[model samples]
Target: MKSRTYTLVIIALAAALTAGCASVAERDSRDPLESMNRAVFSFNEGVDKAVVKPLAKGYKTALPRLVQNGIRNVFSNLDDATEFANNLLQFKIQAASSDLMRVAVNSSFGFMGLFDIATEMRLQKHNEDFGQTLGRWGFANGPYLVLPIFGPSSFRDGLGLAVDSHFTDPVYQIKDVASRNDALGLQLIGQRADKMDALAALEEAALDKYEFTRDFYLDRRAGLVYDGRPPASE
Candidate 1:
């Protein structure tokens, strides 16, 4: 249910952002979404400082290889979804077929997690989404946006999230409310935990974290648009 709720919220956000696009240029620099993004960043930073770092140390301190394997599987699973969607959107029938094969094989053998054997079979993970594909074929991103609690996105991506939610794992379809919330929190925490190294690097290297995130987001979005093609230099 977490994914569904997230989807619904994203759809509502997409509608709001698209409908309010006309006024964004006129709005103050302190837009709510931007403010919320910054706030979440700061909050996440605090989380890292107070919680994530110590836990990472403890995890490494306790069960190093186990943590490593779990993280590997988690991201690998995500790649399957992305690769499959991208291939379908790009109209690459062969690639899409490979993606489905990977999905099916992994879902059963790997127990709903990606094993990354597909990449070894020469099929790469391609970035994609229904909205990005639509954008590439004709639809626009609609607007630059930073969705509340969801981070950076466009109206198109927000819609894509809504669509993508249906294919999410069983964790998203749990009927019990409290259990769903707990699962969602655990999932987000795990995702964030995996990003610790990246965050550390960004904190040290980037002159402007906001610019770094924005540029990175846009560049990543461009990858989705061009079906994994590298973006031209600005």
Candidate 2:
């Protein structure tokens, strides 16, 4: 099932790339698939409103702040492993060593990462991923894309996500299928809950939410690729 799903995603991305060439006047240079992306963005908003947002609200309401923090920490600890790998791929040895130590300290002294002892100990947390690594290796960012249920992404990041999900994500590596799925669901809900306030503010402030999201995603990704110092031309 996972293989089939991955295959479908690859096919969809390929199709999107090919179909995006249909020219539209006044389209943003970074998003030739504006029409398709907007439709997908609308669909994502509908799903979020009807299901994800409500669930996230309930999750926030039911969980104590400490519990939420702990859950977030645990997930962050798991992500450290991915960061470590990507840092190594990018030849960021110092950052990779920090990431490795973070996973070790958090997993052990932090009690399965329910506490972030590493951060308290002055070890900086890094967020590296396959996408940024690819960028460091000089891969171009293709058209902006809005994936169904996944929100903002681009061609390069979409491919990075696929690679991470299949290869690097610790949560996806759980041996038990049920446990892996539960972890995935919990992580999604936690992330959505965490972003509720920021997203609400965005919705209220932005005149064109879709454009704002796309630009923000692109700019932020570019910064990540260049270690917060994107080229002036970008």
Candidate 3:
């Protein structure tokens, strides 16, 4: 039933993003379903406070720095596959090559991505996603949304997540179901642990946390889609 709830949450966010709304320049004008988004945001926040945050804290306290770095490297190696595929789809041959090289080098010399030898070799890590692919092809971002668990996204990005999960991500292709699930769980806990201090600062600084998060996510996504050089608004 917990899985069902997560699905419903994604659906609700998708619906909101797809609904008709004003332009981005108008500031929050794109959020036609603000009420629903806020509710889901609160629900996600409650879940984080009650379960994810505590688990992350425990995980951080228990793990040494070296272990934590290894866990992050493992996930990043997995990300290289998705990033390479997206780069190819977006017609970025150079980036795709770099991503492929990162995977090959790390998986071989880095002991199955327990380290990041590629970075030391000056191989840049490029972030790409199906959402960015769609954007490059002229697909609109639609509206902003605050999805449960997943946090902020747009209609395009939400669909991209689905595509990445089913197609691009190697985690799903793992033959052993238990191992796949364990890898995913570790990735989640590692991510949450890394975000603890940043999240705390956000809570302390933002008077309206929802708005702050929404704007920040949208801006950051734009930066990612444009490879950190988003065009200035008119």
Ten residues in sequence with the least summed lDDT for candidate 3 = 18-27
lDDT, each prediction: 0.62, 0.87, 0.82
Candidate number achieving the greatest TM-score relative to the actual structure: 2
User: Which of the predicted structures, 1 or 2, would earn the higher TM-score when compared with the native?
Assistant: 2
Q: What total of clashing residue pairs does each candidate reach?
A: 1, 0, 0
Q: Please report how far candidate 1 places residue 59 from its true position, in Å.
A: 5.0
Q: Which regions in candidate 3 have their CA more than 4 angstroms from the true location? A: 1-10, 13-27
TM-score of each: 0.70, 0.95, 0.89
Check candidate 3 and list the clashing pairs.
none
By the TM-score metric, which is better: model 1 or model 3? 3
| Candidate 2, 108-208: lDDT as tens digits | 99999999999999899998888888899989887787787778888888888888878887887887887887888898899999999999998789389
Rank the models by lDDT, top first.
2, 3, 1
lDDT of 1 at 184: 61
Candidate 3: C-alpha RMSD to true structure equals 3.3
Residue-level lDDT for 183 in candidate 2: 87
State each model's C-alpha RMSD to the native.
Answer: 4.6, 1.5, 3.3
Top candidate on lDDT is 2
CA lDDT for candidate 3? 0.82
